[model samples]
Target: MRGKYIALLVAAVLAAAAAGVGTAYVRQAGRPTAKTVLPTHEDMQSFVQTANDWITERQKTADLSLYMADTQNGWRSDGQNLFHTTDGGKSWDAAAPFYDGGAADFLDATHAFALAKAVHDEEALTGISVYATADSGKNWRHLALSGAPYFSAEGITRGVDGFSMASSSNGLLILAGDPAAGSHESVVFATKDGARSFTKQADSLRMPNGQNTLALADASHAYLFINGSAAPVFMLATTDGGKTWKEQDSGLSPRFTDVVPTYVPVRMAADARVAMLSVQNGTPAAGAKGKTETADARMRDVFYTLSPDGSVAGKLTELLTDLPLDAKSVSMPDAQTIYALSRAGGKPVLYRFQAQGGWKRVESATLPADALQLQFVSLSDGFVLQKDAVFVTTDGGKTWVKRPL
Candidate 1:
């Protein structure tokens, strides 16, 4: 973003803003271009921005409040970029080019790590690169993982599931595969020197009779959500740093008996509750749309608490069961609150669920189009991810402004 821009690119952003976020004139899909084509500075002029508008109103009353996302939802010429706001969600700014956003673990304002994709060819995902930043986005250090289990992009593009950083110097890096491929394989790596180096922990950690999803409680603790032949939300725990795994009786299997469905990977650290939506007798609403959910897709929002010991807290609370409209996109900000993005009457709608009242529509003036993910740091401030841009809501999902990414 530093060297490509000239005076002419400003005109292009103005034109893009007019045609709207969804219709960017210079949009290209799938990672960078094919390996055969060498990209140029001009090619990035469309997606890359000089910088975002500075936080319009700084809030000095609050002690440094920040919300951030290593946004990787959209098409990008320079891998994934990090966007953050210091004063709640009053405004946001692009922090740095953090590749493989799904694998990003932002420990705080100054420390982060991610598994960078070293594959130039979009066809074969053959290699991986480790990136760590200590002084925020100002600089990054490339780490060594000579024997790291590389990602496989056989056909469908699956990304790094997540990176769990318990502290500045310890973390877990996970890469998952397509769930539709009968059996799922994920590689887990553990690092003690802030990802400066890592040890391959799990190359083929059993997903026996089904697909698997990884839920990390921290660096050494991980929960495996086994779907398909197993019971719904059936899990296995690895407390000894992913060396071995064993099934645990979560004790909530009886609650999800009716959830004849698929699994949605929940990426939260210890003590964080995640809402997993299960489509009863139908495919998962997220990636599977036109498969079998033609009739009413009865969905349920179930919350699970991940313990520090890498086990589901055994308290599975079912909320919003058999709703006509699925919280197709579900996020549990806390144990008591949930935010969901679903289509109502063929248009996207945001709903907030509370223990006090139930699901209620949140009226937002500027939430445009469909959102890919929702990240709410508090009850009031949050970030919504779209394909091309990120929208920030400072007033409890009522209004939003576009942030540069």
Candidate 2:
């Protein structure tokens, strides 16, 4: 009944747009007017409520505006209603037309995208429905997959794992399916017209641990880093728009018998030229014997640089190995400064690395974890998005202030 109610409310908004009743065709952010359906506050009364006891859930935020999955009537359902807050997670507005599930790439404050994919019985793939919000989720427009397949192969459950958008009109979606034990393979699809349409790519990645992270530098270049099922750091690079992908050697290959690196991906990022990756390295699995939990092994977290096209470019650099296992890459504001976030003990801690100096405990953020991504548009201007709070920093990572959600 909750799903039906949400669906009816969305339909009513569309109906109003059709009848030209209460609507705003104002061209914001160079948005096309033909398919725009502006959602009103009253039309989405279900989104805003007096701050209740229900715990808010977190997803990737679209720019600074947070996209949340809040329960209807303080009760969880099959699908939680999507809501957005532009004012530092203060008052949320209903982004009802857009579902809050699946992989999302919130490009900026105005443009965001997601794949509202459908699966059956948690096994069989069902549909590929893509949606985009050009006006920051104020209005979401449905995009045609045109004829994109729901599943790249026969599988019971398929999920949109990630989105890498190089620009407003060019992007890629990776779907993980064909689960085995707990891991699955990945299928690729892309769009060139701001997701107006989509087409599946010929290339797919079949790794033991599947894809770890995908970053598209441009329309022609993309990099996929795996959890190194075969090596300490395994990577694939595509130069021909993913029509072909080739393995990249990191020069740190581990021997199966003499040497095997136990790798745990901490965080990684890449541009068109160089890729930055950090991994938590346990003792050499092949020869560790009984020294697997040695202090030296626990402190072997490393930072590496490689060519974005899949070649080793720089020597291995080690970071503060004491970082939490869930430490995520924050930003590379400059060549000498780096930032990372670790959700250790359910709390977020920020760390900064300075070249020639070392890593420093910047600030133990008060915000909660399960935060999708911490982004910095500039050197001092950065944001830490929580479920119901936003942490803003202006002096690099030295201090932070929380904002209401």
Top-TM-score structure, candidate number: 2
lDDT of each: 0.47, 0.46
Models 1 onward score TM values of 0.59, 0.63
* Clashes found in each candidate (C-alpha, N, C closer than 3 A): 0, 6
Pull out the clashing pairs in model 2. Answer: 89-404, 89-405, 123-156, 123-157, 124-156, 169-194
lDDT of 2 by residue, 184-300 (tens): 667777789888876778535654553355666667676665542423345677776666778875455221111122222222234214344432222223354422322121223
User: Could you give candidate 1's per-residue lDDT for residues 1-405 as a string of tens digits?
Assistant: 000001010111111111011110001111123333322335322212211110111111111112243222111122245554454334445655645433454555566555666665765544567777777556879863432244333433254544555677866665555654345666667778877777778776545434334545555666655544434335667777777777765433222112233344333544453425343232213453322222212344445555655445543444333222222245555556767775455466778878788778899767766554466655786666554566777788899888644
| lDDT at residue 102 of model 2 (Cα atoms) | 48
RMSD of 1: 15.9
lDDT of 1: 0.47
Judge candidate 2 at residue 100 and give its lDDT. 48
Score residue 148 of candidate 1 by CA lDDT. 24
